[model samples]
Target: MARLPEPLTPLIQRTSIRQVGRILSNTQLSPFSMEMRISWNAPQTLPVPGQFFTILPCRYPLTLLRRPFAYSAVTESWFAFIYDIVGPATRDMAKLKAEDDADWIGPLGRGFPLPSPDVKPILVAGGAGVGPVFFLSNVLAGRGSAHLVVIGAREAKRLIRLEWPSHAEVRLCAEDGGTGITGTVIDGIGQQDMADKVFYSCGPAPMMAAVHRLAAECGCPSWVSVEEMMACGVGACQGCAVAAAGNGGPQEYKRICDEGPVFASGDLIW
Candidate 1:
């Protein structure tokens, strides 16, 4: 991994129009990739690495509060969010343009804890799951931690390029072997004891599940971000819950909105 430089962490207190700004147009990173910059009206609080922010669409019934988007990257003035148009909420989000304000709130939820400074060769990310990890890597790179990236996708064409502060040595894996190694991402772990390092992942449920199992086998501490259908982005509604980390499991569901969009790999039923 190349060294990523760090910027100062910002202070966050609440959400307001003071924080939400119109889109400044978007950037096409790849044929399938898009990046958007929402203008922040003031010196918004910098999102600590691993933390996320919620964007309430510009409408009411706040119960459909807003979709929680991970803090892709943050600075003193503005922050960027990346998304693919997979459904209605995203389709609407994709249409946002410059000067068009959207309801926004956050710097919400805890992020993955940074790995110990003594540890390097940390495993990084792939695809949309890249959001929180990107923010985390930005902070870690600045401190000279080295990392390895094993990004997986169904095919090479589906992979998206991101601005990695450290730009760790990237490894690619695909189901079709269209690029890099062919097989599930866990194929990369090679049965090596991954103890002492951290594994951070976010993606489809099945993928995260497989990763959870792999992390356990390697004895690596892992973190994952859960994706669930949600109405209220905050804890009020019970729409987005998953099986719990406890013995009873989903018998006691964990709310994705309130309990977590992120969790320790062991604390989830999947």
Candidate 2:
């Protein structure tokens, strides 16, 4: 497994073994994406930004595997998940209504490390990856941290929008010239320097790899949230493992559901 940074150890230790969240609302963000807000009836452990949950819609018996979703936002009343309707499980999730019950297990895995008070934060998101990135922006803003959010999509119609906190400045990037910068997120970055910023990103692997390259070019440190498929959204299944750079030992694999969905940019073998 890639070596998760020492700072993440404490967060990993604080995760709950399991919990339940009740669905309060499920709204469509785009044709293929839906935003779900779930509330816990009794007090339960809540996830920090970058942490995720494994949810099984009670009605979808056909899909035994729970779906993983990063917490998109959290409030006193509920926490949210924004997911793409890519398959049977998620398509059924779109039919979920307010007050519906779903089996929720989590607040699991490691989250992004807290940033130093003096450093500026740069959040990058690609497509559905915006969920956790949005949550992180809110957390940083609440901490009085100044940050920039760069969001990307395939085209203008594919973009997702949200009310960003006042402390964050939002920039948009599009692969096609229909909106925002007419290029990939990295291309939209142009010649600006990021040497003083701390970077965090979640998205398709290729997009994140590009962000890592950008971080390297400006000599900045970065953290990334990885997405993997899992049968059990816990370490027991070992189904969501990824290769990591060998650190004075043989190559290893880490479970995305447990050790992380988040890791230092330098730690990954990719």
Candidate 3:
């Protein structure tokens, strides 16, 4: 594992907000993915890109634990997430209709750090990781930063549809060559000039590891959002521990929920 000179620190630390959010829409984005929009009252602080929230189906008594999801889009009184229907909880979530209420705790965990004004931003996302990267691209665009977004999936049907930010450039790739670029996200990334650019990625473990290696080769800083099976959305259960590289010191573990879902690529033993 590689290590950067400075350690990555938690950027946001506000107390978690628990609320019953009303479902505004539950739309299917692709064959395997669904987008759920929720609206709440009392206007709370919006979540930053890469921060996650845990949601539980109010009607499903069989589901014991809440599932963590990253924000795909956000507004003043509403937010949305893109989820894959992979388990009992997500299946139930897909069944939910408008006007239903779901229990959720939000704005938890750390988020991606803002890039310096002089550096270009390159965001890579695949599978379920597209949500946060999409949100981040909009944020960067709002700040007058032109960035590149690379999204990948196994096939065209698996790719998510979104009203992408107009200011940011996008590259789409699929393994089956059913979409934009006929290769993986790495192939799209390879076409860019990496100098003076910072990389942020989220996807399957193997894909992120590949991005980390590419970033290292380009001598660019990289941050990754890790996906793990989390029993507790908080650090109490210690269920989502990722091994730390420790640089030259003793190895340790960091909690993905508490310490980060976002971390410097060099900070973890990928």
Predicted structure with the largest TM-score when compared to the true one: 3
Candidate 1 TM-score versus the reference: 0.83
Q: Write the per-residue lDDT of candidate 1 for residues 1-270, one digit (tens) a residue.
A: 212222123222233232556777667665665677777754344566555667755633233546777777776667887666677667666666677777677666555656666555455455676666666677678778777666677877777677565547666778887877787677754555454667778776777788888767766677777766667666667877777766753367777756677677788877
Write down the lDDT of every candidate, Cα atoms only: 0.66, 0.82, 0.85
lDDT of 2 at 129: 91
Clashes of 1: 3
Colliding pairs, model 1? 4-141, 4-142, 50-111
Ranking by TM-score: 3, 2, 1
Candidate 2 lDDT tens digits, 78-140: 779889889878888899888777888777788888677767778999878999999999988
Worst 10 residues of 2 by lDDT: 1-10
Model 1 Cα displacement at 157 (Å)?
1.3
Number of clashing pairs per prediction, in order: 3, 2, 0
Q: Judging by TM-score, tell me the better candidate of 1 and 2.
A: 2
List the candidate 3 regions with Cα displacement exceeding 4 Å: 1-10, 42-44
